[model samples]
Target: MSAGGMGPTLDDRGARSLLRTIPVRKGPDLQWAPAEPPRRNAAMPDARTSGPTAGRKRDPLIEPRVFEAAVRVYARAGWGGFTFDAVAREAGVGKPALYRRWSGGEELLVSALHNLDFPTARDCGSVRADLLDYARQWVHWYRHPDRALAGRRISLDSRARPALAALYEEMINRPRTEAAREITRRAVARGELAPAVRSSTLPDLLVGAMSTHWESTPEGSRARLRRTFPAYAETLVDIILAGAQAMPPRP
Candidate 1:
């Protein structure tokens, strides 16, 4: 294990607290569509009377832009800040347009979560390699400037909000957890890991380590983090694998 490979020593509460340490920088917001002046009325402009493209039936980009905007807003501000007005302002659309599609922030946030691109881990030749691949993918995705701040915020923000927490489980946790479980199960089948190892908690450890690493690092140093991510990922995987391998078999 590398010098930094002390696998997450924090307990659940400590880890949760650490996850919230890094303040989410609002940063440059997502601006998929061109900005338009706010309209007093919540209703969107009639497609027929709108412009030269009036002949077209609908703006296909509207919902997509709205969805993207909703995510950005939720990521930056969490559940409280995730409002139709906020999404509308970000998406460059009228508030009523959002109301027309979704009933409330929870619904809109769910739709946004649905639209998010979830990363996956493929099976590599070895357990170590497989974990490294997953870790690398996890680091790359969450480290993105577009996602970094929002991802962390949403994670902590979900704790108190049952609805948000459920969405997090459905959209984020379940897939990643399943992938981790598969990796560990494959490892056991191939004799790479002992069956007695606490396989179930492995996902949380790996993800917690990654999240903690992100939270602890200074914002100014994240560019370096991105560049050095491969080495970090390798070390992280090795550390996790080493710990699992070291666990004594249960009688």
Candidate 2:
């Protein structure tokens, strides 16, 4: 991989790449829609009233509620408190229902995360513009509370759990790997980057810089990052490309 922003890792792009499991606002500042209790049909028993027994009835609304509750539970408590009992309580469904759907918290969390929606990447025909857009989008994504929390938790906690680690590989690692390769390949084909330029390095540098900036910044000061990210992204992209140009071709 090249040294600066060639193949950006999914780990760094977690906030940017996550599918909107919940409804999300479009554009650069993607806001998560508020979670509401799934509407109950007139004939269906109130989940709160029926309590655990409510899981006995087959309702289409139940599944979405369970998935949404799972995300919230995982986002708030992370891997430690992400248990069926907790999720069931949050969803107002029985634990048995969760058990039937997933063998454990890892499976449930993965399923929930996978079920979310993701934004498509823009192909501006210029690698510079593409990478800048990616970096800016990542900044906007970090501003989302649930996604940032979930991404942080996954990055830290996945280290301890094998299943969670696998989930990370699937959700974060694989997708970014593909994206980085495509971006670099396009750059090379366009003669913007040397044919021998490392595919992963440049993207890694770009997103790595962005991720480090976000992590190092205190929460109280993030508004500044949000405001300054466009210029910051441009500078980072230019620096990486310039450095990439100076690098000698490797065998």
Candidate 3:
């Protein structure tokens, strides 16, 4: 300013302001520094990156042994005897542990029924095959001693225990009915079944027939029933499918 502007010499502040106006030059040697990664606590493990629990083996949501114990208790003592304390004693776990998983006896029974792994309806490209597969699963379930015993006990007590019956209808029967409905729906969609065919009750009829047959079979003849149930399942499916096909279309 003194030489060019013909003015008084600038103060320290004015000189600093003039320096700020200069553009910075970035050269080949000027590279951005890499940012440092966040540090992790070595003592504490992250649960998300690990399993359900960190630094501990993950536990099952409902243990198989616990489910078996619940079934055993229910089968042995019916609804009245199916208490949390009884189930815990049978399962070899504390009542608190069982409570943590299920709120009450009904919920525990529902979970046990779920653990049976009922077959879901699948698309086998043909209604006949789909029905057979579904029925076959029921045959297997009926033959299993633990599951059959539990189911028989529930069926017997359904009238006396309305709450248990409601739970069973909601959790078990509803899903099974829905699966069977899906098979009929698929058949109608493919033109194999008439749109107005009343096949909604087909699953019930099949299940009722199976249950009656099972109950009527004498204890001494259970082995024979086991051997014959597969063929019976096939015949049952065939008869239902034939009737459904022959049903007149609704007006």
lDDT of 2: 0.76
Number of backbone collisions per candidate: 0, 16, 0
On lDDT, the candidate that comes out on top is 3
Candidate 1 per-residue lDDT over residues 2-121, each given as its tens digit: 469876566799876656544333557632333343465648776557787665456678998997787788777776777788899999998878777777776677666556655565
Ranking by TM-score: 3, 1, 2
lDDT of 2 by residue, 1-251 (tens): 55785986556468545642466777978878655656778998765777776555566787788877887888898777888999999999988888877878877876676554322245678888878777767766676656666766777888888988897678766775677667788888898888778788877898789878888888898888778877887899899888888776666
Q: Give the alpha carbon lDDT tens digit for every residue of 68-145 in model 3.
A: 899888878888889999988998877878877787888889779777765566678988888888888889988876
Candidate 1: where is the Cα deviation over 4 Å?
1-60, 120-125
Q: What is the TM-score of each predicted model, taking all chains together?
A: 0.66, 0.64, 0.70
Q: Candidate 3 regions off by >4 Å? A: 1-58, 155-166
Go through the candidates in order and give each one's C-alpha lDDT: 0.74, 0.76, 0.80
Pairs in clash, predicted candidate 3: none
lDDT of 1 at 146: 55
